[model samples]
Target chain A: MLKLDNIKTYYGNIQALKGISLEVKKGEIICLIGANGAGKSTTLMSISGIEPPRSGSIFLEGIDITGMPAHQIVTMGLSQVPEGRRIFPQLSVLENLDMGAYLRRDKEEQKRDLEYVFDLFPILSQRRNQSGGTLSGGEQQMLAISRALMAKPRILLMDEPSLGLAPIIVQQIFGIITRINKEQGTTIFLVEQNANQALKIADRGYVLQNGMIVKSDTSSALMADEEVKNAYLGV
Target chain B: MKYFLQLVLAGLTKGSIYALIALGYTMVYGIIKLINFAHGEIYMIGAFTALIVGGALQITTGLSPLTILAISLAAAIFFSSGYGVTMEKIAYKPLRNAPRLTALISAIGMSLILQNYVLLAQTSDFLPFRSMIPNFPFLTPGKSLVTTTQLVILITTVVVMVILTLLIKFTRTGKAMRATSQDKVMAQLVGIDINKVITFTFAVGSATAAIGGVLIANHTGQINFYIGFLAGIKAFVAAVLGGIGSIPGAVLGSLVLGMTESFGAGYISSAYEDVFAFIILILILIFKPSGLLGRNEIEKV
Candidate 1:
């Protein structure tokens, strides 16, 4: 489980996230939906320690982890698949996966996790020798997710995994996300602009508007709510 | 014909040394995206380390050439790598997050400080290394031909280049290094210690350059406090000539520059030797821009 209390983040003079807070329960898929510049990505980044909150406390399993370095947070079982699918271009797919388990000292566990990634994304296994950059956008996204999964984090944070994918691929990715949550019991904190699709599978959801959480409810409740539908789904 | 062959042989020997030194520039630039100006001084430091160690251990000049070379190389790699790591920690690491220009100026400053440190200690005098390593004039039987020192330089350079190429292409650490060079943040996310990878790069580059410095001292029979400046500049020009970040390109560039200087000095005049290398550099920049083998990197906005 993770908690963000009164989180404030800034990019120099501009306040990106102003006093936003949310809680993600263990083994649950929670999506933070918002329009452009709603600080969805900033919230994920703040939790991952890439951009620590300016004035907030972030807790993982009741332990304060605010202001920890990105790598240290990763060691503590927190992994972020950054917004742009920032895969190491020069590395082969296999090398990128190897990097994900960088902190793991157990070679056998690394091997097992690599197998798990291959199972989750079979395309990655087929193109294990291909350069990370040469993969198609959808495949690259898959690799990025698989790479983060290689870290075997208890909680996975994904930013805009479906941003550039086709609808079919997005559906396939979401199906995989559901399976991952069910099978691995990995808690998922995802940020997205696609509200209708995100809310469908999310156990619980939060709607962010201009850096503040505007609504929170069960997935079906938010899906059926008139205001949530009008504001986020455009129905 | 024999005389010409002899000259060509001599050119290759010297060319190989330039190639070795040029690799240092190329490798550091490949990963860090900064031209390590202090790379040349690493060579200088290696030579001094060899000098001190050889003297302190009482490994006299009369020993077998192989033994002397082995001892000098070990000492050179050890000391130069230590100096390189220290330099990175003190001078480079602090400026890493700063603008690239700031890091570049810091490198130049480090180079100056290193040169001054040597100047204070060694007084800028040319110290002669022994000339017993045979200048085997095999091609020009009975005439002054390229020495064994030059032959060793050529052989050593080739061996080092081949090994480096293998290391970069085949090894996990080498892959990690290339990954870091391509994207530092991404490399870290995957579990690489970016600092350690960078330090390893510096150490490898410095170690190679150290070998070159010792060979240069042996062949030329003189070492000076300020010798690294000219050699470093030429090697840098070589790195740029072959494409700044390309390894094989640096070697090819060094060969071209070396041949140009040697032939120009012979056919024209020694006075214009420096001028010839500079002019060639300018022409390469104007015409190719990416050097002989450098691929143009396209940046998407």
Candidate 2:
């Protein structure tokens, strides 16, 4: 389980997140959906400790992880696939994935995880030696997610996984996300601008507006809500 | 034909030193994007450490020349690596988020501080450096164009280069370093300690620079506090000429600069040897600013 309590984050003088609170129970796919600059990414970043919240706390599995350094946070089995994928452009796809399990010492387990990720995205295996930058947008996105999965995370925090991908590719990625959650029992905290697809995969969802949560409900209810339908679902 | 071959051999000997020192500049620049002006001082310190350690061992102990050489080389690497890590911590780490110009100024300041510290520690006069390597019995001067020292220096350089390539390509830490150089935040996302990686980079760079310092002292048979200044500047030029962030570029640039200086001095006039290096550098800058092996910055879609 993951919990955020009144977390506020800022970039210099400008506040990007203002006293936001949310939670996700164990093994659930939870999504935070909002438009651009609505602080959805900031929320995940704060939890991941890339940008620590100025106030309040984040707890993962009942342990306070607020304001921890990103590297240390990763050791606690929390991995973030950051916005834009941020894959090492020169590193081969396999090397990029190797970076995900950088802290693990279990060679056999790491090999298993590598196989799991390659199986999840078979296209990645074919391009294992190709540099990450050479991969297409969809392949890169898949690489990014697979790279996170290589960490063997208990909670995977993904930001904008579907951004700039073809609709078919986006659909395929979402289906994989659902499969990853169900099969591995991995808790996912997904942040997205595509509310419709996010809500469809998410067991529960929150509508984030301008650094604050405006609504939280079962994904199906949020999908049908009048305001949510008009604003985010493009109804 | 003999004269030209001799010149090429001389060029390779000089290039061996340049490539070693240039690697420090290129590796540090690759990860942190700082010119690390103080890198030269680390080289100077390496030579001094070797001098002090070797001199003391010769005086107080009856160790064989080979043993003395090994100990002195290790000491040089240890002390130089220490200085490098300390320089990063004291001069650069706090300024990690500061403007790059600020870090560069700090580096320059660190350079001055190191040079002065060494000057105060040891006299400014050139100290004689007895060759670390014993004479090779098989090498006859007239029969072989290369001297024992030059041959040793070349072989050592090749060995070092081969080891470095293996380190950068195969090791886990090496992979982490490559990842960090490419994207620091993403490296952290995967649980790599960025500070540790930065410190490791400084250590590895200084280690190579230390090897250069020891080998150059062995070859030239002399040392001075200010020797690192011109050598550092030349290596920096070589790094830029080869593309500042590329590893192979540094070696290639060093060799190119060395051959130019060697042939230009040998054939034309020795007085303008240094000038040839600068002319080649300027040409490279004017023509291919990225250096031979450097990748142009291509934005991802």
Candidate 3:
């Protein structure tokens, strides 16, 4: 579970998130849909401590984690699959996954986690020895998601996981995300511009526009809303 | 042929020292993107630490020469790593978020401060470094060959190189370091303390420089406060020549630079040895830009 109350974030003098508030319950796949530069990524970054909120507080499982360093935030069981799949280009696939579990010390647990990840994405196991840069776009996205899962976080925050992905690949990724939430019982806070697909899988959704949450409702309700359909779904 | 073999041997001996020092430059540069001009001073401090420790051990204990050498080398590495970590904490860490020029100027400033500190603490005069290993010079057909010191330097360098390669490839800390170097923010998101990795880089890099300082001081039998200045510049050039952020590139560049200087001095003119080294560097830069083993990374827009 995570909660942000009246969070404000900035890039130098320019404000990105102005008094935005949101919440996600445990084991729920909550989607935040917004146009480009609509504070979606900024919200995820604020939670991850990459861009600390200038005002307001963020609570993860009732514990305030607003101003903690990014590394500390990760150790506290929060993981972010950042935009553009920032996998280490030079590192091998296995090394990239190893880095995901960097905070863990138990070798047996790490070995089990590695096996679990490989099972989830068999392509990753096949290309375990290859450099990350050599992987295709779909494979790279899988690696990025798999790398975050290697952290075994209580909640996974993903930013634009579907960005630039092919249509069929996007479907496959979304299916995996659904399975990860259902089977693993992992809470997901996903930010996406692919409103149609996101709304299809999400239990609840929020609409963001120019650094503000314009609408919040259950996925079916938002899908049936005329304004939401016109603006986000392009239907 | 004998003369050529002697020059190659001499080049290798000197190159080993340069490669050791240049590794420090490449690694610190790779992680932090700072030249760390103060690194040379770390080497100078390492030599001084070894000298003092070796002298104290001789006077205070009746230890064997081998034991004394090992103890002094360890002390030198420990102290040099300390100096390096402290320098990063005091001089470079604050400038992490600052502009690149600020860090560069700070590194030069730290270098000067360290040099002056040594001058005030130790004498400016050249200090004699006793040969820890006994001389066992084996002659060749044309009266050209290797000494025990040269053999020791080569073997030690190779061993250190292998160990370093293994450490970087097989160890978790090394993997964290490589991750941080590639993507600092991403590394942090994955629970790696970037500060710890950076600190480790400085510590390990400084340790290698310490080994180089001790070996070179032993071989040359003299060390002055300014010794690090020229050596530092040469090592920097070697790093740049090999591609500033690539480890293998640094080693290869140092060997090439060392061999060039050795052959130039032997076959051409000893007076212009440094000139030959610089000329090679210039030629390499003009032609390759990226060092021999360096990858030319295209910036993603």
DockQ of each: 0.48, 0.89, 0.80
> What tens digits encode model 2's per-residue C-alpha lDDT throughout B1-301?
9899999999998888999999999999999999999998889899999999999998899999889999999999999999999999999999998999999999999999999999998998999998878878899878888888899889998999999999999899999989999998889899999899899999999999998999889888999999889889889889989999999999999998888889999999999888887887789899999998888888797
Which structure is stronger by DockQ: 1 or 3? 3
lDDT of 3 at B48: 88
| Candidate 2 lDDT over residue span A170-206, tens digit each | 9999999999999999999999889999999999999
Model 1, B123-196: lDDT tens digits are 78887765434445463535546556776788889899999999987777887788788777777666677788
Q: Which candidate gets the maximum TM-score versus the true structure?
A: 2
Best first by DockQ, ranked: 2, 3, 1
lDDT of each: 0.85, 0.92, 0.91
Off by over 4 Å in 2: none
State the C-alpha RMSD over the true interface residues for candidate 2, after superposing those residues. Answer: 0.8
* lDDT of model 3 at position B82: 99
Per-residue C-alpha lDDT of model 3 across residues A1-235, encoded as one tens digit per residue: 8999999999999999988899999999999999999999899989999899999999999999999989999988899999989989999999999999898888898899899888888999999999988888888899999999989998999998888889999999999999999988999999999999999999999999999999999999999999999999999
lDDT at position B41, candidate 1? 92
**Better by lDDT, candidate 3 or 1:** 3
Q: What docking grade does candidate 3 earn? A: medium
Angstrom error of the Cα, residue B57, model 3: value is 2.3
Q: What is the interface RMSD, in angstroms, for predicted model 1?
A: 2.4
Write down the lDDT that model 3 would get: 0.91
